[model samples]
Target: MNLATHAALLGWIPVVLLLFASLPPRRALVAALVGGWLFLPVAGYDVTGYHDKHMVLSAGMLAGAVAFAPGRLAAFRPRLVDLPMTIWCAWPFVSSLANGLGAYEGGAAVLFNTARWGVPWLLGRTLLADRGGVRALAVGVLTGALVYVPLCLWEIRMSPQLHAALYGFHQHAFDQTVRWGGTFRPMVFMHHGLMVALWMAVGSILAVALWTRRTLRDVGGIGMPWIAVALVGTTVLTKSTGAVVLLAVGASVLLLADGARVRALLIVLALAAPAYMAVRLTGEAPRTAVLDAAARVASPVRLASLRFRLANEEQLAAKALERPITGWGRYGRWIAYDDQGRAATPDGFWVIALGQFGLVGLAAITAATVLPVVRLAVRLRRRRAAAPGAGPAVALGVVLALFAVDSLFNAMTNPVYFVAGGALAGVDVRSLVRRRRPAAAQGRAPAPVVVAGAALASPAGSAR
Candidate 1:
């Protein structure tokens, strides 16, 4: 994934897109922002030891700084959701220091680590700060992945040469691109073909969510139904069972419940993934029955992989327990070893988080992501009232939960996840503000507040 500086400087293409995106009817900016994230080369130009798409993030951070500068202070105001996120961001420094690595080295590592989640989270909070913004973010993701569909089709035929052709190096192992039936899987510009499948899964779910709410026209056009099907087609082509499973899960939730309930379900799911990991790590869960069920449903190959991951996670969890509080910290410290002292990388992101940051760090990150959906779901259910951004919030929350669980299987380092999370954070905070408005503010009676504005709540005070 390393793009040489000359090739990496080309990363500015999407940041440059912001110029035209600013001319938007809003979708324009979303397209630019998301296009920048999805299309940009990953691991472009290292800062310290961690190399990722630094230029892409710089584009977002640059935009946020300018947008919130000077007279625009209120737009930058913090909400209850920010508290855990703030902790999430700051705790890395604590963990880094605890690593007992040289202070300077630990500090440097922490800076780039912050970029992994912090920067994109900030982009959503600032750039797309409203329901329109949230919708735009979702559509932007759809379109961004849509843009990849053609590229994916190309790779399916030609194999994944796009990154090497464009950036002068392939992003992943050549053998991994060769799939079950000997067909080539599309990697596009992502770290792995699985990552491509994951993004397509997110896009498919997002498109269907938009179509259900009829906001597809706002972002894509009347042809969005077809577009959704096409995205689903791409997901199937990915040959990654996880993508297919998530698509069914997302669509079923959308069909059965309103956005609030969907979000509440997401809260439960968010908690459950880690909880299972906790149980599995302790060997306290019914391992035999779980594997038997997975064997019954999953192909033998897939079930074997799952069992292997569970076994590895158990080993890593035991090692992590030795330094339960602050965790093993950077380098190869978080990795586990056998009696022969051979090291193994923990396969799950949650496992890695547990081994590296311990429970404190894990809880902080999990809460940072989950609480926004929880807050929105509660607000949506309690007053039995529509909430601002609930439609987009629900869709985004679904992606959030799907991705969170997927992270247990995959690292979930895709910047778009953070962008969605930050947008949900903004949506949650904004809904809270609108709900808590003073009677004086609500008493003014502003245009009936548009009752059917697709989950934008009317002021309770406006009621008879």
Candidate 2:
């Protein structure tokens, strides 16, 4: 079938499943249907992008289900998970208004992006705050990886020139013109390679979680090491240095947090660096001749990346000074013309926030993005120490760490980030609720006996 036909079919499948979910015999069917819907193939089928189509269809189904079936809706009520973060995210809207930058269409842009992320986030908070949501997310990641890995492999094999032609690497055409590499890195369905890499990184992390927990062996018949190896290999093939760094850092954090000896952790990190450098040096030539010599060592590649990022950072800083308070309005750079009638680079995310909305706007964006992840981290540590068997908390912590690291390099405004963020928020909010509920505290026991037993049974159990 064609792409549109496939999308329409998949989209309708959910609706039919919802109908069945409303029936007594097939209520368990909805969960599986949702899981399957998330991983359905859309490779050749470009029916308005699978994610976009799924979002639209899912929204419609959710609305209809809520209207027709209050009981089902109640099953999806917002949990206490990450409520603080949800509240914090509201600051951007307020800051936009305060800075008076929202006067033009810029306000609308802020509102639109915020709503796009915030709404699903809220929905996720309600629907996914429980074990089922956790399972759904895990299943989705594994399924997405299963589908995405082979496609990525094929694209790399094809080395299609069309990849760059379609995506347009770097921020501007001039960068592409100046660079030695192809126009864009391959992104079969995602917006860019960085995004694809980020998604793969998340998969790799999830794979770690699955392997460590022994879930992969039980469910997928795959050993943990094999899953980890596959995920790490896929990440490397993406040619995203940032993603590689993220994986390294995230893995380290996971290892330390899980109580690996500090000295052993340091030794592992120290040894891993040289090995990583060797592999990276041999991977690909630099983007420019000047960078090629530097690529002889990994430090140069890292420095070059940092330098470009810093340049963008500097440019943004200069622009922000022009309107430090309210700054430029939304799409203000587009509409607000200078004496020379030239537009400047939007630069990095920090600069984008400042230039677009000014200092006030930047602060709002910062709080919204930072607070929940921080709160989640703190809460996870406390919860894990007190209870210990909180799988969802551990997973959420990994998600937070990945986002925190990746956001420094790429914008966190993508759909994948939002979807993941929403799920994490849901988990966090639920944890908070459990902590606050007097009845829950009084009745709840320490971390589950199963987790404690597992910890004692095997040395590898410490990996989780």
Candidate 3:
């Protein structure tokens, strides 16, 4: 059965709307609307998929109504921190219009993708930035990983030719093949082995944060160490060298940022030892063997895989140089040349962004995206040091670290990444704006609230 077809998409419309309605008055409903819109593509209803654009519009209208509802609308206001990044990130779309490439319909693609993925994440952050929401997101991520990891293990066991058919053998061709305890390598719902590896790496970083902060205690009776072991093990099974490196780097950053000097060192050594053993077993060498070896031990198979990635990076770099200013345009590198031109790398996020958006676009996009994450990391560190037991700080730090690593090789601007990133960004923006409230309140007197029939009447006496 095409499960997508059997699910009733329209049913979710009201359900999502209700969820927005139920939120606290001070909460941002635009986030909910944006997030609800993001799920439209994946929402199929009994052989008839709901119109995605329509869903987005409806959600937006509902959210806007809620936001404009007198006192309810206070949460929807954009903050100073949000403005800079939003404008910076939007520059690419703006530039796309300025360039002749705008005619190619890059705007539609960007908008569609952004709505499908970015909106939900922004809403998730807005909704879940509170201690309760942050915990929910953390649990949701771990639960999703738990469910996804086993499915990946099953896929690996099946050794399905699906990946080869979809992404092609070149993109997923690994240097080594190992059937661990009769279990094959898992690909799960992702496109390739590398993607799976990336997911696992993300899982590991999150698990570490959750474990260290004792967030697992919230789950009742679940041991933190066991969760960490499972996450780390899954990362190893994916056999993605880049992902492994990213996990290590991300975890290290998280630990050091959190000031767990001894624990961080111990965790690093523990995670590194097995990787070293794997490398020793494989015997094949990686392109950046020294760096890879220092981070984690690699087997011959792992080494070969790492070498392939480095080679792809080199090729992508050269191609980017050819069109240093404005990339050949979105997906332009994917256009094959008749033995006359070089092609884009098969699996490289930086290369894709650079090749598609050019150096100017890349710099602008990177700054827009990375700046908040860096700030969050710094803020979390300060917050935790000053006030202990701030688990949300650790969780945010984990998210930033994971993104930092994942973005290196994967186009995290994709749907999932955007959604998550948007949510985190929303939270950051909300917190910043709320902080200025005290000083602002001292200057201007507060307005009185008037409620009517589950909705607040605006100051102008209009039902918001």
Over 192-281, each residue of candidate 2 has an lDDT whose tens digit, in order, gives 556667777776876665556443342233455776787789888877777887777766555555423322332343234233322323
> What value does the lDDT take at residue 177 in candidate 2?
21
Model 2: worst 10 consecutive residues (lDDT sum)? 448-457
Pairing residues by index, what is the TM-score of model 3?
0.64
Models ranked on lDDT: 1, 2, 3
1-464 per-residue lDDT for model 1 (tens digits) = 34453554554544445443444323434544565556566555444423566445545444544543323324577887877767766666677778776667556656655666776677677666675567556656766767778888889888999888877788789898988776798998788888899889888887777667654442222266777888899999988988789888887887676645665676676676767767776677765767888888899889988888777777888888887777877677889888898776576787788788777777777777776666656556533323433555677878887777787877756777776777777764444325355446756642221111111112231111
Candidate 2 versus the native: TM-score? 0.64
Query: lDDT tens digits, residues 171-211, model 3?
Result: 23343334556555554334355556666676677677766
Quality of model 2 by C-alpha lDDT: 0.48
Weakest lDDT window of 10 consecutive positions for candidate 1: 448-457
* Model 2: lDDT of residue 184: 29
Best candidate, TM-score: 1
Per-candidate RMSD, Å: 6.5, 10.2, 10.7
- lDDT (Cα atoms) of all candidates against the true structure: 0.66, 0.48, 0.48
Candidate 3 Cα outliers beyond 4 Å, as residue runs: 1-74, 83-89, 92-99, 102-106, 116-118, 159-183, 218-221, 252-308, 321-323, 333-342, 381-389, 412-416, 423-464
